[model samples]
Target: MELLDFARGPAMEWAFAIFIIGVLWRLFGIFFLHHRRDLNEPRHGGAAPWWGAVKTVFSRMWPRREFRERNTYSTVLGYVSHIGLAIVVFGGAFHLLFIRDLFGVSWPALPTAFVYLSGVVALVAFIALLVRRITHPVLRLLSNFDDYFSWFVAVAPLVTGLMAVAHLGARYETLLAIHILSFQLLLVWFPFGKLMHAFLFVPARAVTGYVFTRRGAAT
Candidate 1:
């Protein structure tokens, strides 16, 4: 089969299926298998576990004062890069069209020009992050194969996409197929790697907030 057909056909199907199943399995395992009875009593009468979780979800979006003071630039850069990537993935016209085609759901999309700009910025941001990981003493010491692998998979789609858009390398069809295939690889990798943090962090932060609330402390 031609590369394009394979990428868009069976490869896409299997990658998507694995992505969905893996993510669901991980989530179910987290919620079902990890529960243990809290033997200890709440410190402050245990008033609002669920409410605390909800509150923490929004509260922790902004960094604490100490962290903000220390890493203000890094934090802001992270947010901008993340938000830019989100705009490209979730708000781009082509992306939204694909979402609609797959899920029968539709939403307004951002302008194509903006999406393109955000894509460029996100590419730069991820490159910077990878450089930091490689160069920083502590991060380099702690890094492993998963770190580099995840970065490559995360960045591959964007690089191929930008190349396709710019018509800079191979034929447009080939570049586009590479872009889609890279994204498929990303989907397959997402649940198995640190990328799972995208989904897992919610429950984790919520539980942390719940504990803090039980102690009568603010999240």
Candidate 2:
């Protein structure tokens, strides 16, 4: 009860504050970066810049043709886990409640059983990803603390959340508290880590597409 109280009260407040501030800071930096003036006339036979920007954001979801075969398995599983996580976060009743409490938003939620199953699937995908990273030579060479810690934070909430739902390892309150704490850890690290890619990737890719379109090449 005490743990739950702390997690639901002070820790939640602090974590939410830090997450908001950190995300805004990173976004401000991205928007304020120096830009080179576009002096050249618009090139012919290229994608329209603004339309290309919007198009590339969705187009880049899949791997390029040249890299498709080599990375197909990883890419597919990544999407599975990503979609699962998205369902768990945005479609769960409890998650929607949290969002409603946080941002005054409201929406219909999927069945609890479905949300639980999605969490389980997402967790499994993350485990497979870790195993692949450990065994693949090139991936192992590139792996670092950021890679592992980000994985931990990403997976921790899922593991703890499942545990909470099942009432395993502790009383429900304690388990729930730990689950919330794990999520808070994720929130704290999100903006400073690879998780920022969730918010940054679309804009960055759009800008890349726009710039390339301006150069008369779109890839």
Candidate 3:
């Protein structure tokens, strides 16, 4: 019942430090590589006009836009997982309390029920994404180590958190410890993995739109 006692102290500190460094490295790599793309040339042919590219992105992401078609299931699931994870991370009571305690900043905490619901939603969304990868020919063809690893990285925290919440294992402390460790691992892996899409997606979308618009393709 004494969950806090599971702290590994020094080892945890070292692990957290390494994770932070790895995340930074990954983020730097993504932004660095993205900047290298040729902005003038279309990534694919038949792109729309330049202005059209900007319009497309905003229109689709905007609420209640009938003109915007749904993205592919893979894309939708990917966004869902990311959004759900964000809700869990920023809206959770623990994260808010941590910020208040450590940095003297506070935000309204999501209700405990909402926190658990977000975890469930994120888990389902991640699994749906994995299934899309497995079932879709194009996605399966594109699959690589990072693709699978990213799913595992994204799902681990949710699974562990749910287990900890349920208190199902022999040692609740052990389960809680694993949950914390998994969460830390996710943060470390985030910047380096496909999860960096969080940072890169907007830029990538803009570039993709520009390229398509130039070629007179989908707007």
**Reference-based lDDT, each prediction:** 0.85, 0.91, 0.73
Candidate 1 similarity to native, TM-score: 0.90
Cα lDDT tens digits, model 3, 1-219, are 344444446445666687677767766776666455445754454434667667766755643445336445556676777788888878888768766865798888888898889888889988887887798788899999988997897789788878888887747788877877776677667766787776766766786777667765665
lDDT of candidate 2 over 1-219, digit per residue (tens): 889999999999999899999999999998999988989888887668988888889889899999999888888889989999999999988889999998998899999999999999998998999999999999999999999999999999989989989989989888899999999999999999998999999999898889878788865
lDDT of 1 at 83: 87
TM-score for candidate 2, residues paired by index: 0.94
- C-alpha positional error of residue 39 in candidate 2 after TM-score superposition, expressed in Å: 5.0
**Candidate 3 root-mean-square deviation in Å:** 5.2
Give the range of the ten consecutive residues with the poorest summed lDDT in model 2: 210-219
Enumerate clash totals for all models, in the order shown.
Answer: 0, 0, 12
RMSD of each: 2.0, 1.4, 5.2
Model 1 worst lDDT window (10 residues): 70-79
Say which candidate scores most in lDDT.
2
Q: Which ranges of candidate 3 are over 4 A from the true structure?
A: 1-8, 23-72, 207-219
Off by over 4 Å in 1: 45-47
* TM-score of each model, in listed order: 0.90, 0.94, 0.71
